[model samples]
Target chain A: MSTLGLIFRELRHHKANAALVVLALAGTVALLVAVRILATAAERETRRVTRDLGFNLRILPRDVDPDQFLADGHSDKTLPADAVTRLAAAAGTFVSFNHLTPSLERRIQLGGRDAILDGLGPSVVGPGEKKQPMGFNIPSGKAYIGHALAQRLDARPGATIDVKGKALAVERVLVESGTDDDIRLYTSLADAQSILGLPGRISEIRAIDCLCMTGEQDALAQLRNALERSLPEARVLQIRAIADARARQRQTAEKYTAFAVPLVLIVGAAWVGILAALNVRERRPEIGLWRALGNGSVRIASLVLGRAVILGVAGAAMGYFVGTQLALQAGPRIFPVTAAGIVADPSLAWWALLIAPGFAAVASFLPAMLAVAHDPAETLRAD
Target chain B: MVSCDHLVRTFAARAGTVAALDDVSFRVERGEFVAIHGASGSGKSTLLLTLGGMLRPTSGAVSIDGRDLYSLSAGARTRFRASTIGFVFQLFHLVPYLDVRQNILAGVPRPDADARARVDRLIEELGLGPRAESLPSTLSAGERQRVALARALAKQPPLILADEPTGNLDPVNAGVVFRRLADYQRAGGTVLVVTHGNDAAPYATRTLRLDHGRLAARLTTEVL
Candidate 1:
């Protein structure tokens, strides 16, 4: 009989034992694969969530003192009306810039108290536009009154507010934006610019760099540098904290995977090692029988090690397949927004496929060596 | 032919090291059936294993066909045993998953075109033809022994070793096993067997008795 035939028949004789080892190894691999997919999906979702929060860069006319800008929360500094248009031509796919020019504040009697109003004008940032500048844009002659101003004026949507002798309908009472938005009146950009007597100009340029850090480049930092260079006459304030949050979250996920991947494999190896050791002990008589049948130590060792390798390969493949399905099912359930479908991460898949079997081989190595150490005379003589 | 010169084997016990074979020496020529009788722990099984080079002697040497058995490496000794020796045990030691035919076929170092025919003839001659396809677990004690004997003869080795080949068998089966060993000796094959009972003495051309790991010098006798 061929050696392969003998090995195969031996497996059949102890099918249950072989199956037990494979099952344990497969479970370990499956868990690792699932976690890998989860980590990838979470990192991707972090980026998207970070992007949707809003732009971290503000471009206002240069040479404005930070103290003055903070005290008034208004700037007479203006960027060219065609600045965005001109920049668009030179911008790569990464740029997402927009324009907004708040009207000069006006005083009028509202609920017996002097209230100030400003119009969102020049070119209103639209709702459907990709380069969104904060809230949705209002139509011509329409206004979004701040929550505090509306309370003070005893006004709501569809009410008229006259400022600087121009009457504009209140389109909607703005929710308390908690920042400068609570006390401001917003109108179309063109109306704001016209009312401020600045034709074809803007107070500030609001833009999202669409800047994501990746293998291509440190796009976020690069975007900041590009903006400072191209619009040197404009003050570029880089938004922080949120971008830092995204980066930190991504780092945490990577670290967790780094620690977890090895932990799972070590556990897998341990479980398989225990099983292999026990199997070797149980098969001592058979090993002695083979030795007495004139098989050498190397051949005897091969009988045990060969089976371990085969089981390792088989278990790895099965675990990878099962893990993919589990990740797909569990990910969506755990985090509906972030956990996407199966990520075809070739490296992770390769790692799972390669390492699982390698662990099995290592797990079985001691037992295989021990199998060879048995003296055929002593083992058979015991009977 | 096989020769041993003052062979000694010791194993470490929990108390201390104890010798299993003490200055034992013997030789067996071709075409001889030699039976060894001893009480349990008298080292009859150890003697068989040492002669086959499965166990290394603590002292002295064993030579087969003029080549020092222990002088060869482990791998070479294994190959030598496979090519030159066959073994039968009391428990049959047939692989539980294999059928009788496969068990018999396993003894050959490598099967050739005539291997199947040889195996078939052995099974038929041993009256195991009807049960050849049956697994070892399903065979009767007598049937199992016959399969083991056939396996030993499958490779056509010049020397055969049997350790208590009939220890677990009934008298009828024991007689049959001895007869098979006798037949191989008559056909110019060397056979060395160890049995607890004297029933196998009639089948051997010579008998040697061991006591306390030492051969009883004056007890060696030629069977008449």
Candidate 2:
């Protein structure tokens, strides 16, 4: 009879033992798969939540006065509008900053009242990145009037307003915010440059730092170094509060996964090893009989390790299905923002199939060796 | 033919070292039926295992059909033992999961149509036809011994070594087992049986008595 035939018959006779092994393997695989999928979803959710916190890095012209820029909430000194293009074209610029938007902000008189006129240019992202542009994109002939400014100027949606002898249609009225934005009027960069009589100039380039580092890591130093190499004429200023929060959230997620994966593997291996040892103990006489019947060590070891491989394959298939289903069901409740992006990952199935069997075999290695090294004469002569 | 030259086997006990076989020497020609009789702890089983190449003697040597059994590599020795000898134990160490047919087939070194046919004939000759497909757990003690004997003879090796083959059976089952071994001898196969009682005396052509790991006496069947 074939060795496989014997194994199948033995497994059928010892149904409870086989079932327990398969269940242990399945539970380990399930936990790993769930953790992997959920970790990805958590990262996506964090990126979305933090992205909404707004740009935290402002790049101003090197000669700008810090006190004047802070008090006025706008820079008097300006750089060429093409400075945003030069920085975007620099090597490794996106590695330190993203969502590069050029803006020119100034205080001007509108309808006899002082208001902030903010000119927003198109955003340039990293190569091959499909991220949505942050903030508003205003057309050259249109304006987005804030609540206080719209009330003071009697401007509503679809109403044309006069600014510096230029007529611009009001596209939409922004909602009331408690910040200075409530008295600001948004326009295209070309419109602001034309109206201010200073063409091809922008006050600052706005961006968010890409270094997800805590305050202790000196993230500002790294940002400044990267800026110095790429755009020496401009200096970078980072908002500590927002950057620190994003770093802490990302690190916490990573630490959770690092702690979880190994714990599952160790427990899984121990469970498999113990059960395999028990199986070898139960089949002592059978092993002796085979040895006496002229079977070699390879054949004997195959009987034990082959069973583990078979069970591992079964467990991998079952675990992948169950874990994917679990993630699909419970993911949206945990991260509702990117819940729709959660879907079954086919590559996980391939990885599970490749690794689980090898893991089981390694776990059962000592037991298989014990079976091979067993002395047949001991059992046969004792009988 | 089998020959043992000053065979010595020892064990390590808590008290000290003890010898299981002390300078034992013997020989059996081809087609001879020999029985070794000894009391419990007399080392009859140890001597049988040593001769079967399952246990290596502490000193001296054993040669089967002129091949040095211990000098061969472990793998080659195992393959030689598979093709040359058959073994039967007292406990009927049949695989619990396999049925009688599979247990008998397990003995064939390289099973083919001839081996399968021989196994079928042995099953019928030993009166195990009705229980051929039954697992060892459901069989009676006598029937299990019959299956074990059939397994030993299934390969039709030149030599058969039985260690208390009827130790667990009744008088009637013991007689059945001896008669089968005698039949194999009549067909020109060498046979060696080790037992505590004289149950195998009637069928053995020669009997050797062992006392305290030493050969006490040797007698022919007619001398008994």
Candidate 3:
């Protein structure tokens, strides 16, 4: 018989034992894989949402008169034209700036229908900003409307909509940024400032981005200090990294695995060992005769271990099947949806299935060791 | 081809160290059929174990082919045992879960073609072909013993150690087993049998009688 054939024969001898071990290992691997996917997808979704909203740090004059804009039915909070230059000089890097005011309740005419307009814009952004989920840039007299807001205003691209008495044509529809994208609009900073009638006053300087060291606490401290020194009047904030978000979710997943994996491994080991012990006890004379017949300690040990490997392998295979079924069934709901669509990675679950059985074999080793360490002669001679 | 000098075996039980075999020594040459006749606790099995390299001698040397067994490392000794010796038990300790053929093959190092062919030939010669696919539980006491012999012979070892190889056999199967051992000897294999039965003593070239932890006599068949 081939080595595997012999092992298979031995494993088949104890059906119940093999099943238990495989189930334990499969369950552990499945749990680990699922949690990993969950954590990863959550991180991805968080970053997607954050990036879609634009501007990790939003800065404005610390005190802005809200009543001035409200009473006059229009307001502009435009900063000085040199504000971007100043921030660029202070940060030692050129920084892009966008001017925006949150949408105020007001009326707009879409076609012949009057509807409440909810749009804010006239923001300048860096190169990559336009591609973000909820970001857009337009020239004067044009606007990008949210899907929900556009539907409410009966507005489509190329259609004119009145925003606070200033008429602008819709340039595009902002699709799928969840609820936030549905309620906002996009316009050029100049147009927003002009419409709001506050040409010299900017509402808030929307700070684009500055990449920095994530792991080095001292570097982060220095960077924070630098931002403070550079934009002293504007509060500086650090945006969370995609890596940090992923790591946090992964940490939560790892915590679950740390507690659960050992339990599964120990249970798998014990199950194989207990069954093997019983098998050995039942075949005491046979084991003895093997030793007496010149089967060395290693051979006897192999015979015992071979049996456990068989069981472990069988169990791992079974568990893998069960786990994959679970992952496929549950994976979609956890990720929910992405900007593109629902996110799922089936290969990760399959990888878990393939890796679990090897672990099962390892778990069986301890039990195999205990069962093979017997005195052949004495065991054989006993009734 | 085998010798033991002043061998001692002790086991520490809950009650303390008990001497199972004390200062025992004997030898068997190639092609010799030797029977170690002893009553219970007379150390016949212990002597067999020490010779087989399964049990280490506590106080003396046991050698095969002029090489001291204890002098070899643990792994080497195991290889030595696998290559040089085969074992048969009176109780027919076949692995019951495996089919007869598989149990027979299990005696060999692994599932080599030669081992399988040897086992197949042994099965046919021993009239076990009809039962080869069956488990041990399906075989009679005599058939089980025959299967056990087939397993032992599968390795084609130079030495055959039988711990009461015919103990569970009836008179008819006992005669068959004894004749088989004689045939093995005729083929130039050494046979050392530990037994309580004196009925097979005439078939032995020499009888080493064990009584109360010592070899009482090395009697030839004529003398017996």
Candidate 4:
């Protein structure tokens, strides 16, 4: 028989053995794909979450006394009349900023119970701030309320709420966002300042800018720097850094997969080896005959390994398809806010296809080599 | 032409080192059909394996067409065997899964036009054309041996080695196996047949008998 033909036949004979190897490799590749998808999904979700929360950077006073700021907890700070314009102008030098605060407090009865009132607003920066229109466009006197607060207060869109004893219109009921500041209400900067009776005072400012760092370090550093520069003494606080949190979650997921992938591979290799070795042992006489007729070590190795590769490829392909279904199911459950509300990562499942074949080849190495190493003469003499 | 000079083969089993062949010397020229007759455990099979280069003799020189088999590197020896020799066993060690045609083609160097043609011709000559696609398990003893013979001749090797080519066949089928061997000889191919069957004596150009791992007697065609 031809070398390749012989190899094909050998593999065909040991189909089950080869299949086992392929299955193992497919599992490894699937694991790799899953971890990859989870990681990418986590990243995508973080970005979406950040956008939904309405801010990237929180700007506060750099030189204010920390003791005094904390003493006025949750209360409006009375800065100089020009303090908001000055801080806005300085921040405008480097980046865009939007300042916001609770405008009016609403006391409403819902289900015969009193409801808590909170407010949100867009911050005001200098006219030099890029994208000035979007930063300034907050429907004045209109407000958005949290779903929980709305439910408790029986609040509806366009309904009026008693904010600090003044009637204010509720524009929309906010979705339940999973962030630290989700329970509060939101309104325009001008309206919040007027109703809170703290004119020229701003609680927080949001900045939309990009930074270049990867993982937790980048995120923590960016938050620390923005808060330190904008509100050094004011004690800059962040609602949450989604990217860093997701990164941590992905890291934890990958760590477990890393441990599991190799364990599966090891077990798979062993199982394939045992099966192949037994096959070779059983075929010793035939192998001896072929060797005596003139086949070489390489030919014999091919005969054994070729069978394994075929099986490996089949199993891997099956596993990849299964993994794709799994990813589809997982995407929606994990992050339901993307374009399709499902992960569309281009690099998601493609790498797995290539890795499956290599896994099969690797799994067959020892058995194929061992088969060729047996002495033809000794085997023929074994009776 | 193939010749063995001062060949010594020993096996180191768990008990002790046992000598299978000791200082055995012999020679056979091209186109000669020689019979090596020996009783069981008389090293007839060991001689065949040694000549096939499957076993490394303890001390010896085996020369095929003036090239010492042992002196060649392992890879070179393998190539030499592929191009120069064909072997057949008494049990007809056909791969059970492959059909008759594939079993015959197994001896040929892959994809060689001349080898392919040679196999085709042998299959036709041995009357296996109709059974070419039949597995060995379904073939009769004589037909299986014919397939084995076709395989040996397929490579057009200079030397043919047969170890009891008809040992498993009845007298009638044994004669059929011998006829194929005789036809091979007529085609100018040198062959060595190792067997205890005295019935094979008539077909050999010369017969050498072995006793106790030593050459005992040589009888020519005229004597037979």
Give the winner by TM-score: 2
Better of 3 and 4 by lDDT: 4
Error of 3 at A292 (Å): 4.9
* Arranged by TM-score, best first: 2, 1, 4, 3
Q: B1-224 in candidate 4: lDDT tens per residue?
A: 98999889988889998878888899999999999888877888888888988888899889999999999998899899999998888878888768888999888877477777777888888889999999888999888988888888888888998888888889988887787888878899898988876767888888988776678778775675
Which is superior by lDDT, 2 or 3? 2
True contacts kept of each: 0.58, 0.56, 0.39, 0.39
TM (chain A), candidate 1: 0.64
Better of 3 and 4 by DockQ: 4
**lDDT scores for all predictions?**
0.77, 0.91, 0.66, 0.68
**Which is superior by TM-score, 1 or 2?**
2
TM-score of 1: 0.78
Best-to-worst lDDT order: 2, 1, 4, 3
Candidate 3 ranges beyond 4 A from true positions: A41-56, A59-165, A168-190, A193-235, A238-321, A328-344, B109-118, B218-224
Per-residue lDDT tens digits for candidate 2, residues B118-186, read 999999989999999999999999999999999999999999999999999999999999999999999
Give one digit per residue, the lDDT tens place, for model 3 in A328-371: 56756655564233334567545654555555445545545655
Which candidate do you rate higher for TM-score, 2 or 4? 2
Which wins on TM-score, candidate 1 or candidate 4? 1
CAPRI docking class of candidate 4? acceptable
Off by over 4 Å in 4: A1-4, A7-59, A73-140, A145-157, A161-167, A172-184, A189-250, A326-350, B216-224
Which residue ranges in model 2 land beyond 4 Å of their true spot? A70-74, A109-115, A138-179, A182-184, A212-225, B222-224
